[model samples]
Target: MTIKAVRGKRDGPTLFVSAAIHGDEINGVEIVRRLLQHRALRSLRGTLVAIPIVNVHGFLNNSRYLPDGRDLNRSFPGSPKSSLAGRVAHSFFNNVVAQCEYGIDLHTGARHRGNLPQIRADLQDERTREMAEAFGAPVLLHAKTRDGSLREVASDQNIPILLYEAGEALRFDEVAIRVGVSGIINVMRQIGMLPPSRVKKPRRQPMVTDQSYWVRARVSGVLRALVPLGAFVKKGAILAVVSDPIGDTSGDTEICAQDEGIVIGRTYLPLVYEGDALFHIAKYKADIDEVLRHYHEFREEFEPDAYDPANHDPSEYDEDPPIAS
Candidate 1:
């Protein structure tokens, strides 16, 4: 419930960046931390309100739900008279989200799963689509807002919002973190909260898709994945093989893709049960080679080794102590 507001010397739009609605998704926490330390804020035009942890109860226990066993995310625009999760959701939505003109909710894959860096938003809206493209993640998913979720409520208020999904729950992926930080800055620039970048680079045209489905394990066993995240696959291609953990090869089953698409998400843990989601495939009508080309360029642009604090403008450096992981 801690909120940090950084106001610029001039007036502009107010953008709120939130993380960890699920508590266990800690990657967004780091993204928000690094974003606050960015020197670019020195010349910022408007306001940046950062909420690093939204579910304090779940965060404390390393769980995804409140003590009442309720998901805070599904309790949006809640009532004070409702349950614990609803009350917290009410307070945060009204006091924080209600005041922002734009929002970016950060998240990660659920427990034991990993997601490629991607932007999920209602791309049908022109403003939201612009913001999503500006963020420049490898993939852009045209996701419909779920009922009772923050994005749905925010959209109802006419406040454009973007949801970023990456990495995995409770673990940090350096690439995902870096991409998150840079993507936020890109959105700020796009929305006129920050100046345009001086260094001209290739603009990111993320692969866009509205169709996706999960490839699930056919049998309960240990999984050996044959493909990595961002990998392209044809219809009926082998994505993984599930074998008996007790060394019974007779029951091995090869999980195959249901459609031609890219691997956007998958389970990281080898142990899985029957019908467990193994690979999240997003189908794209664009040429596969072109999609992959953009993906590679996105990776090259945000590679960790390419960034050095000392190489940045002196004003970009902040004295804030690093957050403990």
Candidate 2:
């Protein structure tokens, strides 16, 4: 693990930003790189703790689990006398996470999947909601922190953390990376780490959802997605079609939405078996038109004409360079 601290001359929140906790999720690594390149941090009032790659063992192997076949994320607040993953998690919690006042964990979808830019936070926390809104992602999920997860561990210590999910694992999506970098900077501004922007805030507020579910394939076949990610669909809407690749509709199955929700995640690979999750939807209580309007506005903000830093490759810092005393 590598750590970078950009401390301000004045005292402020120590925000810990971590990425690549799942190893294959490389978009967060790029997000951290781009975040370090921003000039706004020069005027920062707080400390920014950046750890671009937390699971070095998994990252080097391009695998999501550690050598011991354990997910590093599930081993939070681990013990020194336990497994390898446990030891790693224990060291991280003691030496790094223990020192921070706030945190932002970046992540992407698993293999063969893509997620729309969204913030998964505990809405029960008012400060967390404010930070999530400030991040300005199109979708906000009232996600409950899983047991033994980083968010839960942080919450125990009274540190509010936000998790940003976007793109796909093992690949960098330009749109995902751009939105992530901007979102992190926005949160920094909102929390007083950096000066506020003179430009007005985002025109459309992020759509919040408390209920989400995965629409699974009913039969084994080649899958065809009818709607893309971020699409607003009503209950019973057809989200995808599964058909036999050899031009047979006898085995076809239409995966329909079970609730009026937005498509927050979907399988990118067309081939799928029965019970495979195809479209992940999030239900909202407000008018569907409002969600549609917000989605459209978010897309327009990232039009081709707009500047995107992900279009260029930024140099990554060498991990743990020797510091001159």
The sequence of per-residue lDDT tens digits that candidate 2 reaches over residues 136-219 is: 899999999887788889889888899999988998887788788889999998898988887875557778888999999888
* Candidate 2 residue runs with Cα over 4 Å from true position: 303-325
What lDDT score goes with residue 301 in model 2? 73
Candidate 1 residue pairs in clash (backbone atoms < 3 Å): 39-316
lDDT tens string, model 1, 1-325? 8999999999999999999999899999999999998989999999999999999899999999999999988989899999999999999999999999999999999998999999999999999999999998989999998878999999999999999999999998888988999999999999999999999977856889998999988888899999999999999999999998888888899899888999999998889998888899999766778879989888776555444545656565443322222
Model 2, position 213, has a per-residue lDDT of 95
Model 2 residue 228 CA deviation (Å) reads: 0.3
